[model samples]
Target: MASSPSHLSSGSDLEKREKPLSELTLDKPAESPYLNDALEKRVWRKLDLYVLPVVSVFYLLSFIDRTNVANARVAGMQADLKMTNHDYSVALTVTYVPYIIAELPSNLLLKAVGPNWMLPTMLTLWGIVATLQGVVTSYSGLLACRFFLGLFEGGVFPGLVLYLSFFYPRQRLQWRISAFFSCASLSGAFSGLLAFGIINLDGVGGKRGWAWIFFLEGIFTVLFGVVSFWLLPKSPAHAYFFNENEKNYVIERLKDDGATGKDASVDAFSWREVRKAFMLPQTWILGVVLFCDGTVLYGLAYFAPSIIQGLGFTAARAQLMSVPPFAVAFVTATISAFISDHYHCRGLVLIFSSVMCVIGFGMFLGSQSHSVQYGSLFMSIPGTYIVAPTLSTWLANNAAPHTRRATAIAIGFILTNSGGILATWLLGALSPAPRYTKATIVLLVFSVLMVLFSALNLGYLWDQNKKKRVIREGMDRSKEDPSLGDKSAWFEYNL
Candidate 1:
């Protein structure tokens, strides 16, 4: 391997020429178990089965437990507690404050403790807090529960994104991310149907239907968390079900795609990489794009029941109506993700997704008909759902060195969930009952902003690739430094 010359562009690659290729993307595969194409397929199937499904259920339960509070509101808990729209919005806002504060620290802790410990612990704690929401007697009690739930749940989304990156290369990651993340859409449908049934249990065991919604759903999370503590493999290499050939394939492919540390794991934390992630242009730029998506996402999650019920339906009927849009979104997000992976494009897919948001949210503001506004949700649900996996994968794909990628993911999530804080207010406080024109208008404007920003991101990344191509053509860049990561001439940005 040729050493990086002092004149070979500026920055970290020049700063640490002596750093091992382990910190940079490996150009060649290391020695591995006797492996063939068929064996590789077999290994990936195991990963998809064991890893993907397990994590999906973790997120599904977590999301359901979190959002069922909305269902509870419609089922009569809000009135029972004497809460106003402002009080409900305040409780929801309380959740997101902790959520944003805890994002980076939680990812860093996930790195320190490993997913098996950090994820299951967080899941179990949040589950307990969610269950306790059922028994709260005052508005203050509800606020306290929401705060703890946010603190525990804050890490799950970013943690899952980082955890999956451990096993798959950049190109293949978005689909797997989609596969699990699609569960987020499913959770809404599931919450609706579950609330529909459980709310029927009102007056059973001296508990109202809304109370059962929390108790039953939270208990389910607790049981799942206990099982996950045992079921989840520590990492790809530690997956006991995989044969030696499968393990090596996972390790080698990841390292070839720029895994750090001995044995191609995520590696120990680096302050320099964390700082590098903070300084990247994409970190803040795309973070704003996510802010728009988060507003729509939580708007739907927190207010969908109320929004639907306001459309001249009974509360229980509204719960059932919310199901189909999410069902459609689950399928839409899955298909779009496959297309994203197959085409190796994130920016265009994001633009298309954002445009769907524009059309969907626009209908709410543009039309006076209830059915038309209701119909728009079909498009709106999938639009916002698609953004998270695609945008998060884009950052994860570009940032290199394990710590840098992980931090970039956390930062993106922070900016993403911060929008949820505004969502509680906009979709709840700013937009009142019976006719939420204000919320509809806000969603529409944000959708347009997202479309514009997605285009900007695509243009910027394309120009960056052009510059890197020039550097690659002019130098023996393979020898420069893997530490350059996505910044290196060797890496072609996925546009």
Candidate 2:
């Protein structure tokens, strides 16, 4: 087996790529003196500077385009299309069907083609579809747009998660993942502000105010997608912004961090790894958490304007009021993610977030005062948005090799968009406007479910870790089995 030094100091291609799967070394050497704490921090900071801003804008735009239907509804798309309440609900649900089915394959293709090409291409296609939503004269036309939009947007979020794993180690991923994911919260704020301004163009170009909303945002998205091709690099090894030494240092940090565990022998795509992801207990448990949390997350994002308007504000006032809760969530979500990373405990932070969500939803359910219900919106978003990034990071970190991690993330999001479908149908469409009693009750129930599932995941991971230790005490080092991946006696799951 080769040592760590041989791998880090090799030619431009990663040394791990050159080694046979069976002969790859598992231990990471101690850091060299030249790679000091200050220097390492500087490198990570520069990397963050390059990565976070670019991806964040893409995430922001994608979210705005997806959820802007709510804003359009407030400005009058439903009446213009002659759609009933249930029809609107059905429209919301339609998107997730293709969104769920396309994700796994999209991720696998990303592994083949790389993010540099795939992500931009998808964004541009989705953007064109979003822009066409403005021209759809009939309900069927709207459904077609929604379905195709879902197909294109499906891969982007999970693809972002898998792509980040290429550059960051498992333990260091939480905050960086959160940094980009926080853009979802920011999008809520931006969309509300944009809606407030765009709704004034009620008769522009012989189109309604809602049509302008779609037209303007979609145009911006198309332009951004084209620009992303130049901004996003294929991998750290091939990053254009980095000097040769910086590229070497970045890859080396990631390799060193893999020493403790979650190291699989095969770096190439494997069918075995993909199958193993389906069988892992954590994947389904996390999926349950995702379903519960996503019920609230997308509920708020897709229906916040409606919910707030239902709370007694005019449609215009509701558009402006939707801004603050999500703005606050953007800050709290980032702080909670860093706290989880600092403690190296994902499930506990997840449990805390779920508990906060329960309180938020409960307040909305029980209170008659609109003021108290509005205050409760603050709790809803921060609590729910925190789950997506943290839960994805936890699942991706525990699953090994590229293919398994990709598969697990895709499956988890299948459940998430499934929850989104339930949210729109249960909370928005079936329930009456203004008093959304069903909305509060449904959100409250899901919040409690999230808490229970998070606790179960915590206990399960702890028990599994204890079992691994017991096995480690009896195992022989010379007979170490790399094939076990995360199940190996020496591997420890970050709780």
Candidate 3:
């Protein structure tokens, strides 16, 4: 039966038979194994397991080191050191000075050295300085340590954001960034609990309770840093767990969302890109939002225990009281980030979170009853924190080309640090004891401003999208060829 069909065919017959195979091959496209839904989910899970904890630990320590001064102040740091002049607030503000100045450059350096080496090393350095803060005798010494601590810790947040961007796509980033940031809230709660234990060690080795707070936290930071160097993945291209096909899929999927280039090459920053970042309206809007959010965040972080004490709680008890709000913040931020990611919506969630903050501040301003006021604190912490990570992740996702994204992130971070400075200065003169009415009012106003700005931003983005659609339809009407018009597509997502 085969002999009849297999006899040498004429060229015309051969061509006719070959045509169907050729058409079949072209018509039935090869299903991409790389884009397998199950595989992508698995990869994401692996990345989450590996990266989230290192980031959480790193930021937890960084946040603790940064804000433990608040705890220390309550633990008799000011009274023992004769810091009666309210220079502690000055010291706190000074920390952000170096932090703002150092942020971009430190992240650039992280690019050069690689995260595995640079991050852990920087963490260790700051940990040492944080510990040294405990040993400072003179006001000048504390100032010096604070300055250096800011300098070293400045790299951690932006560096971690950049690091995660290398591994995850834009939509996946918000929750991871939120998870990373929730460590800050967790640190607040943990620091309180940790301080509660350490304060009991008062007079150990002749050190005050505040000194033990720094000493123990700093040492823990150093230990975690050592662990991080080994555990942290450098980049997706170099990740040990994924195969080559998986790596390529990760890279290609990111390209679909406008990110390009493999993870091995570092994107260098350009002045042109820096200018583009500044020109983006979203950048300025985010700056304002961050400024407002920071006022609430830092005001509460820096002054919460003091405010609690003013409400008639003892110092240790105030520290304990501060824990519940931050604990609420930790849980709320995580839940917000997860829901934001699951829905693939960023702006709406951020606006809702900001509104929650406004409500919290309203309650805080109106109420004097201890339980009601404390309940309001819960709203403030979670609301402030929930917006921040989403805001940051939104900025990161909307910014394009690696270099521009990095610059935009740097600008956003600088704005955030500037907000921290503004927060400190705004609340600077508020009395340590009695009511913090002035600070409370400023925070409430800022929260309202954030809501207004967020609404304006949503409107602006909607208008831009409408304009883009009009432009696209006009082009389609005039086009000779659909393929050529597609190539000329100029629409971009508004941040």
Candidate 4:
């Protein structure tokens, strides 16, 4: 193991290349104290250009493939399949059953097989499934396709969150993750535009407009997946675009933030860490928060089209109307993320976002006026879209030892995705329309509950940070153990 002093020193090319995986260290003893602005800028530019775009594109397609069923419903899918209202809801629900079940195992596989291979491959499989959705003629076929689609799609979100932590430091992470996650909102807007165009091809091959939506989007996803397999780096040290110096800078930079536990040199998996993950209260706290957030987010994604249509527009117009709110959400979410990174506080933002949801959903429930209800959607998007990236970043910042973090992310996602199941059934059961009063009320309750939970979690982190500071003040430097890493007294939780 490299000691603190060893970390600050630079190694020769021979040392760098010859260093064994088990002996790899993230020390920066030889690094310059002054900033390498040009090199740093280039590194970020490459990441923004190469990494973020591919990841964002993958997620954009994922969201579209996952939620396009809602768009399909209004585009005449239900009538074509002769789906009862309950059958339509059942199709959505079936996807989540496999989705939630696969999350933990999929994240574990991400570590074992490597993200560059696992993520894109998963995308390709789901793309095939999504395209096949267009060919399904009956409710049973729809259910089967959805189940397999969910299984393939399950790994991407949590796996990506875990994969990203390997690259960015804690302070710099949320915005980048937010930037990637903003794709979901962008997808919402883009889905409408794409659907609008595809719907025009309604009789192009004797297929309905909704079928065309799935078929074309799925083809696009497959192409992107092939591109991603070539584009994505395996890890910081393995980045083909970076030289030795840049790779070292990347490693040292993240290690400085105590984020190197699962570096390229570390072992792939650890059962001990998996057990420890369950012991962290933050894991469950963040999971509960995600459950609340996921409900509103998926609820919006799965039903916004229906909601817009009920406001007195034709199906086509409703699809077009859905574009603006997500566009606004993209903007609002980006702004909120920048502020969150600037202040290094997720809790305040979490509460603010939840309040946005409460206000937006409340207005939707209370107001009979179409314009007011529609305006409420603009407020709701920022609220729902902001939570996942913010809260996921918060959990990523705190969870440690790569395995533990992966497990925590998997658990949180599994719980959160159950919210997807809830959203589908709730929408199906309440079957509210024109106002969707009952569903809106349920969303409001969850949103408010999230606010309370975020506040409590915030206080808990603050108190923990305070306690760690006290422990650090009294601890002897020589007696301190670097192996403890995030468990060390010097390791304070980022609020």
Cα TM-score of candidate 3 = 0.87
Model 4, range 1-495, lDDT digits (tens) per residue?
113233324555345434432255434322222234344577777777778878888888899999999888999999999997788778998999999989999988886788999999999999999999998889889999999999999888998888888788777788888988999999999998888888888978888899999999999888888878898888888888887777777776666567764254443477877888888888887788899888888989998998899999999999999999999888888898898988977899999998999999988888889999999999898789988889888888887767778888898898889998888867776656777777888899999999999998999988888887788675674476544545666666777
Q: What is the lDDT of candidate 3?
A: 0.75
How does each model score on TM-score? Answer: 0.92, 0.91, 0.87, 0.92
- Give the per-residue lDDT digits (tens) of candidate 3, residues 62-172: 999999998999899988888853587788877998898888877656656788899999899999999999998888899999899989888788788888888887767
Clashing pairs in 4: 7-27, 7-28, 7-29, 8-28, 8-29, 8-30, 9-29, 9-30, 10-30
State in Å the error of residue 44, model 3: 0.5
What clash count goes with each model? Answer: 1, 1, 0, 9
> Which residue pairs does candidate 2 place in steric collision?
310-434
- Give lDDT: candidate 3, residue 238: 75
Q: What's the lDDT for candidate 2?
A: 0.83
For 63-93, candidate 2 gives per-residue lDDT tens digits of: 9999999999988999999998899999988
